[model samples]
Target: MQTELTLNERHLYLHRYPTRQNETLQAWDAGDEYLINHVEQLGLPPAQNIVIINDSFGALSCYLSKHHNVTMVSDSFIAHQGAKANLSRNQCVAITHLNTLNELPSDTDLVLLKIPKSNRHLSWILDKIRNTLPANCRVVSVNKVREIHTSTLKLFEKHLGTTTTSLAWKKHRLVFSQLDASPQPISPFVEWSVDGENYSLKNLPNVYSGESLDLGARFLLPYLPKDERFKRIIDLGCGNGVLSVKLGQLNPNAEIIGVDESYMAVESATLNVKAALGPEFQFEAKVNNCLDDFAPQSADLIVCNPPFHQQLAVTDHIAWQMFCDAKQVLRAKGKLLVIGNRHLGYDNKLARLFGKAQLRQIAVNKKFVILQATK
Candidate 1:
């Protein structure tokens, strides 16, 4: 596998999970190099406080922290973990305030951002920065040539100020936007409803499938268990808590748990559950990796709409981990309800893990299938 080889004095090794088939030749993308090159040209000394957004791995943070005091933030707990793991693997300096995107730290001097794939999430992030960024803070967003254009510039202009783009380097471009010095009002959190239920979400651009309710979630909604007395229920890999909300509404008495590797997903799900069930509704929502810390035989039901990819790579490692974790945490005869693309053949996985799998629902497009597994 290829790695991010920093300067000779310091380096960080990074890798995406499920190993890319041709990683040796791929290595870090141009976005990584562009950020590094920009820093070098500026001849800037170590920053007092630097905030990094949406760093997929340790690519940007690992390099910047070598010279600057860096605070790494990301929506994905897995990404945060990956960055730290890579830092340790390369023996880099400990990063300060390795926070999740659900909350931003105070006193940031400079910001380095990797433009996220979701525009809505990105807008939300810009809004947050608008409210907190210092008067002199510099925010640089970078992406591939096709990913940046007039629309991207407008997004930054809306929240920050007039933005400009750099000439293309290795087919990647950098977006430069200055924080507005004048005190401006921060926009209210976007209020939207899910299936007629009210919700308030604080999203950042780049959160996986953030713009709308996931289609896979819609297909699985009809199959939500109506088991009223369910003692313990979990939403494994709950993105935005849609599955958990459905489960909570159906089984009001059940103690619902929503777990995701993304801090943003956990935050969104927590908001969704509270909005759907009201303020008194209490449940456990946390940034966790597929029941990694769950106790054995602790759950009676596990509902999941497993993610199919991590970063830019499409792989089933996370889905497999969710299924395996479900099996480990579920008691004998406990059930695992899952939704996934039919092409992914999750049925075979359930069968292997639980000894039996049943098709509960299949969408008309055949793009998704809901499977139930019993341990």
Candidate 2:
């Protein structure tokens, strides 16, 4: 994939985090280029306090940090890591990084936003921008033209004020808005419950399937293994810690860990697991990219519901990476259990990683299937 980003007649090398040799995707996209070009065209003064939201990598940060004081805000651990790596690779000046939960820097002079896939997440961010930034601060955003609907523009106008869009360039568009609205209260966490369980789940705006238990999780809940042999377990890509909570209930002796990339997801998971299993329970939630830093051959069991998409792009690389990581982290004879949509063909991928003889089907339904792979 393309690694060189040519901005203002200068080239910067960028890569996605957990950089893979065979990776075929680039770190930056047209939206990033459009924003960079727009900023260059405007000729903003140096040393401005700029806040960049949801930069997929260091594309905007690395370019802007050269002359501006940049602060990046994002929910993704991977994106943060990517930005750091790319910035260092290009020897760019260091910049501040913040998670979605952090308050915006009070002295912000400009905001550069990359529109996210989730409307709820966009709304949450817009609300925060409205509540935090000065009224005169200019807010500029970028996204694929196809992704920006009337509703999306209305969301910006509703939270901020007087939003408008530029003509499409390279199938991407730039959004401009003024922060003229009064500070509005941020939305509360969404709360829901399983049909017959007493457990209550609370999800931050960006957590996957936050409003309700998704179909795959609903189908796999009843079939979660209750074995005592599993002592150390991980819920990979644990969105709201629902799987970890259930694992805690089933395997009381196991040290349950919930791992996800999103800060909001990790926070929601921690809160949900604590509420469901209590503070005394042996459970931990972490924000990480898959099992990147996990110990080799350490886990006794790994229960995963891998995500099929990264941001707005629908791809199976995440699931493939999760399976690869699971294989490296599983101890001898340790098992990995996964639930995925049948069409995703996770069974074939698991078999490829674990060998045909080591993989087995645990359960299957109309749309979902549970597979087990022993190492």
RMSD of candidates 1 onward, in order:
3.3, 1.3
lDDT of 1 by residue, 1-375 (tens): 556565535556677532445554333577988888887787786666788888877777778887888888777777777677767776779996454354566688788888877777677678778777776888888999998867878888887887888999989999998876343454423444555444434433444466666778767777788885579998888777777777877788888888887776777778778877877765889887678778999989998888877776677877888888888999887888888888898888887777654434434455877778878
Q: What TM value does model 2 have?
A: 0.97
Best by TM-score: 2
Predicted candidate 2 versus true structure: per-residue lDDT over 314-364, tens digit per residue: 889999999999999999999999999999999899989999999999999
**TM-scores vs. true structure, each candidate:** 0.87, 0.97
Give the Cα lDDT of each candidate: 0.75, 0.91
Candidate 1 local Cα displacement, residue 2, angstroms: 1.0
Which 10 consecutive positions of candidate 2 have the poorest summed lDDT?
179-188
Leading candidate by lDDT: 2
